[model samples]
Target: MCRLTRLVACLLTLLFLVSCSSHSTQREAQPGLFLSSNNLPVFMSSPQVSFVLITKIQVPVQEGFDQEARLRNTLAVLTEMAAEVGANAIIVTNAEEFAAAYNRVSTGTHFLAGASFDLSPDAFKHVQLKAQAIYLNR
Candidate 1:
């Protein structure tokens, strides 16, 4: 009876791990909001389309992780933010990378204008991407 109980526990643990792994893997590949400069000319030329506002969006840096994964997550955040504002599309105007350096080690830090945070000198590295969030009149 003890052996059987142990086996059941082990199987449940395995199942839990497998489920968590599969869920994370599926999320990493999903696409976010529309990103492009191709439609700039078309959107600009049309009188119907109007510019909303220019803003900067930052995605938190993943700690000691894969660059591709970090970028994917960041793009997801940007997409969500744009969607919240009812933006038609996002135009990346510029980007800047920020880091906190301590003992010759650099880590990313996230910051935005008119926002404040309290953190130790050494935090992390953050990529601040400047984008123009636009919404069409019609």
Candidate 2:
């Protein structure tokens, strides 16, 4: 019985380790499509190549990600969204930063059988991206 218990414990530990592992997948840009911030591409403005606006998109900023990573993630998300709706290009219109409020929770072990919990309101930096998804006709 003791041997069986040890085997089960080992298996459970392995399972827990596997569950804790994380894998992140990044989206690849579609061919002939591009994402740009602010200015529209010069080629897009040419009379030879006309474009039509598909829809406007807004991506909420993700907390805990660095600025470069956030921009990459945002572009990936915008590209995916644009491709889903058959748009071939994305032009970022604006980026706005503001403070967001949330609740922060803290917990501690109080005596032997008791626990303590504290909750407070906190503010955090937040950003939002606005863009237009467009399809080009060349």
Candidate 3:
């Protein structure tokens, strides 16, 4: 019947639209100092190889994520940043995790009554990574 045909067309159109949507976290490389296809390696000092420091990179660690996954994500982000600056290698200088605290205050007015509350400070652990982006001449 006509209704069935219209319903099928609508569903097909909806499916097409959904399939065309892009993932929010997908990263696209921009044309920069180096080709994105080039795999960046972690630099290890050697007597024969020479490298030049391109720039330094630092990424704030995210809390509440799996340790391995967080490390992988950090590496990916660092690589992307380094690649943008034409670095062919990276040397991780520091990775440190420390305890941090922050205080939260809530204030509200209820029907002409003003109320203010100070919440106890919350403690959390934060990590930071520092690396040097370098270009190696081999």
lDDT of 1: 0.44
Model 3 residue 61 CA deviation (Å) reads 1.5
The predicted structure with the larger TM-score, 1 or 2, is 2
- Which tens-of-lDDT digit does each residue in 1-138 have in candidate 2? 999999999999999998653322223423344444333332212235576777767665444444456566666776676666566766676643312211111122222223234421121212455566677776
- Per-residue alpha-carbon lDDT of candidate 1 for residues 1-138, written as tens digits (9 for 90 to 100): 999999999999999888653111111122334544333322212244565553434444443345456544545555555555445555544432322222112322444444346543224333343344555444
- Highest TM-score scorer: 3
* Tens-digit lDDT track of model 3 for 16-134: 99875321122222223583724988643322477777777766543334555556666677777788777777777664321121111112111122422432111111244557777
Better of 1 and 3 by lDDT: 3
Residue 120 deviation, candidate 2, in Å?
Answer: 12
Candidate that scores best on lDDT = 3
Clashing pairs in 3: none
Could you give me the TM-score of model 3 versus the true structure? Answer: 0.50
Ranking by lDDT: 3, 2, 1
Cand. 2 TM to true fold: 0.44
Cα-based lDDT for every prediction: 0.44, 0.50, 0.54
CA deviation > 4 Å runs, candidate 1: 1-50, 62-64, 96-126, 136-138
- Candidate 2: give the clashing pairs: none
Q: In model 3, which regions exceed 4 Å deviation?
A: 1-33, 44-48, 62-64, 96-126
